[model samples]
Target: MRCARSLVRIQSLRALTAAAGGTVQPAATRKAPHARSLIAHEPCGQALRSLHTACVLLKNRPVATDYQEKSEREGEAAKSLVTYDDLFERAALEAKTKATFNQVLDVFIKRDIRRRGHVEFIYAALRKMPEFGVERDLEVYNKLLDVFPKEIFVPRNYIQRMFNHYPRQQECGVQVLEQMENYGIMPNVQTKVLLVQIFGEKSHPVRKYQRLLYWFPRFKHANPFPVPHQLPQDPVDLARFSLSRIANDLDARVTVYQLPYTDVCETGEEVTQPYVVGIQSPDQRHLLAKHNPSRPVFVEGPFPLWLRKTCVYYYVLRADPLPPEEKVEEPVDPERCFYYPLQLELDLERDLGDDDSFDVDEVDEGPVFAMCMAGRGDQATLAKWISGLQETNPILGRTATVFRLESGVRELQSAAEPEPEARPGEEEEELQSRGVKQ
Candidate 1:
């Protein structure tokens, strides 16, 4: 066997040397030991033969082919398992803000010239924009659109256009627009240009852009009372704005009972005072004055009033439903206003005439005498509000008062039954409302 192996090695070396046009000595003239030594000395020939043998063995072996295929499959599966959120997390290491979000996009853009996995990246960006605080930003959205390779997604022919060319990418682009629409962000000219650049003039995203352009302007000012983007930072100012918004009366006046202040006592402990803001119209004051002193009035809250993203607690000074026997109907003056008639005697088919009243029965919940927003919702803080109301209405001083507050955030408690107390031994923001006679 050793002699055969040596002969084979010597034959390979001779064949290589002959192929190279160099003079080769016959393997028959050399001893097996000399042939082995010569084969070891020629590195190139030995390496070539070893490589050829390896290739032949690998071709014939099933295990190596299966292993190579399995490894390739595993690599693909692992790549597929990696989610888009990981990309955002990996990119925005410091903080998830607009700057970080843009940095991530820029990295993805410059990472590959082709912008591979862009559809997935855009979807990830849409999901993350709210966290990054850039969902409503037009420029960020434009930058996101700019990720798609220009003119590639555009259908070349009418056949491609008719058959939803690049369906996945088009859907992705539409998804981006849908998210923008959900946020009530009106797409701008630059947004249109980006859409046109990414998807052709006759694409779903471009159509969406057109629809948004046409309809956004029409409904932009549709909301009569639009909340400002930035709410007031000062609690008092926020309370004032919130109170006035719910008041709905132009004649309603807002009063600040206390300004937020911090004071250091002689003991060197700091005491923080919460603000108190109250609103009442003349009609509300009149109603309060007419309220029966024997019947109890309720100071009910911390009911939540949401202004944009910020939530505020407001208390209402209200009474229970007035009994039917006690309810009085006030007569309207005929000549109160010439421009607008008080009532219509002729009741024909109600068209678009002066009769704007709905035929439904009026809901009489109760008269809200006054509403107030306070920094702290404790009984002590609210008692000050009732005292302030007395200066105007004077009926509060004589009237029986009850507190109907709740421990939960944004919960409304019925002033009718004031028996349920907040469960004891639990630390929460509010203490339960108990019926205590004033």
Candidate 2:
């Protein structure tokens, strides 16, 4: 009976191997039946099972290899797909104007009904807005907000709302609003409507819009001295504007010494003259008139004055601080004030709480006689300005003028100087070459 059971197990093992497409010889075909029975005993069961598993794997090998190849090809194809930035670059190839920018956005909308990869597209658009000169434009921002699909990201349930559904898309929307805020652009009614349609009423982007509306009005005119957006393009006009801004006094008068012009002489050389504009008030003129002829007045600067993004330079005529002995105080005329004394000598003590003055150092610098802006900072150009000043205040000629000009100022090319002669070594080399030829 044991022999029969062993034979039955051997038969079952042979059947499994054959089904797995592996060869198994029958006992009648074997040279020694005794040896075969010993090999197919119960201990051989695990070995037979392992052989069958190997046969099964061999049969499926081709399919596995094919599946791996197919997966690699799919990965390469995914990598080859064009990114959102490529779309903007392609549009910019023609022109990077506002019209081209709008056309690119329009093409993106028409290309896909579902607007795939829109978050990436919006980000790319935001970065490119400044290049196309539409960073401050409200319409472009509204159009960008329109790219997001409506009602998809809006939360359907309280759980979805609590967890901040579609966090990436919401963040993208907020970034668009942030860029608008940076450019000082206020969103319109259409922007609010678009945000509501895309991200629901309680989203982060909506809150940002509410905050902008609440605070934009309060700070719109916050700058006490607001500069004009479009500055004067004419150099003379610009000089006038800058000089008046620095003068501070309403009684100041602007004098244009020279207007910018280009002259072509009979010798066929082009000569360009820079503009000179100066400002002086009644007080400044009066101070200049009292200036002593013994002491010298200094022409100092190309001090920098910034108006918005533009930088301009101006020069000032000032004097050295007088010595303590030379300083004279003007006495007040008591006849002008009949009700009370014009000069008061008081000795009053005050509490520390009553002191309202700022505790800062007082610099006793010399008084500024006048201020001027010119296209050129060279001495010759400034000399013409001084000549012009002598007309209004003749005292400027009597007071010895000293130039304290700094090299920081931009000076225009005054008739280009002749190039220095060749170096001594090069001249000697030329003489040697001529002697060798002889």
Candidate 3:
């Protein structure tokens, strides 16, 4: 009975191996019958099961030689697909004209991983110039300039690293210029402007001055606008006369005082008004009189108007805001809340003082003096005053520096808003209108 069971198990094992696409020996081919009979006498069932398990494990295992052969075939196919001939054929087929050829080359250069950063691709295109029949022009150079990376990224200290890399970028631009020179290509104003933009900040002051001197003469010859004899100096003052009536409306007089620099007028003296008749100068009284004939003039001199040594003192009565609806139990001090002390220093040379007069309008034709504001107060209030001064007196806006006094003097930041970007079609419309007018 045991022998019959062992023979059946051997038959079942052979059937499984054959079904699994493995070679199976016939029963008649079994040479080791004695060994099988020994197994049948012992635990033949467990032995057959163990044999079957070993066969399954061997069948599922991958062959190393077959895998390696498949990989080699795939690699060869990829290499054939990406060869230089294949790439060049595709690019040439896509490009018919010079412009289109350049576009194709640009795409190829940008997309090619091996040739992205290097200029060898450019040289390669130049070699193919005969086939494309396209002569390299300034546009081609500009396109090449566009290919050079303008920015580089660093994982740490990105902003600083970018700034440090700027000189290297400028060097690349210089190399482009040298290449252009070798090709006997003369750069247009636009190309020079591009180089100037890249290398200008790093250039020496003397070179910058020389460039300006060279260009100024040519620019002057073709200039259509009016050119002034001299430009304005710094620390210009702009004052606006208040139209509102004071306590003694009828008796309120515009008194022009040529007081000494040391005199500190009291706030209660009613002299701390916003409006002033005119600036009093000992030497330039006649000039002031000639310009503003109808306005009252006062001559108060001994004020040193020398270079870097002159000082102008202004005492302005702070405008009070309307009281809020909710009444406070305690009265707030006007000196603490409203009035803030301010000092200003003149920032112009004696010679440039005449330019300041050009900035003032005909109505406010007072002497232009560039002055820096020096005092502690609300920045908002200071900004308001500065804007008013700028609107009423244009000279101060252009030339004067208003400094904030808090522990030390610092220049007040201008509150001018940035201009908005024009819409897409607006610029085209403007150009069209301008052309029609011309």
Candidate 3 residue runs with Cα over 4 Å from true position: 1-89, 93-97, 105-120, 126-131, 151-175, 193-438
lDDT for model 2, please.
Answer: 0.82
Error of 1 at 176 (Å): 1.0
The Cα local distance difference test for each model comes to 0.80, 0.82, 0.42
Candidate 3 differs from the real structure by a C-alpha RMSD in angstroms, to one decimal, of: 28.8
- What candidate 1 gets wrong by more than 4 Å, as runs, is 1-84, 347-363, 408-438
| Positional deviation of residue 273's Cα in model 1 after best superposition, in angstroms | 1.9
Q: Which stretches of candidate 2 lie over 4 Å from their true place?
A: 1-82, 329-359, 408-438
Clashes of each: 0, 0, 7
**lDDT over C-alpha atoms for residue 327 of model 1:** 86
Task: Summing lDDT over every window of 10 consecutive residues in candidate 3, give the lowest-scoring window.
Answer: 238-247
Higher-ranked by TM-score: 2 or 3: 2
* Candidate 1 per-residue C-alpha lDDT over 1-438 given as tens digits, one digit per residue, 9 for 90 to 100: 544565587567656645754232233223334554555565443332223333433444676777899999888656733656777887567887888888888988998899878887788788889888898898999999999999899999999999999999999999999999888998888988888888899999999889988998899899988898878888888888898899988999999988889999999999998888999999998888888899998888778777777878789989999899988899888899889989878957856766766698878898899999887888888888888888888778788888887774544566897685666663243433364555
lDDT of 2 at 348: 83
Better of 1 and 3 by lDDT: 1
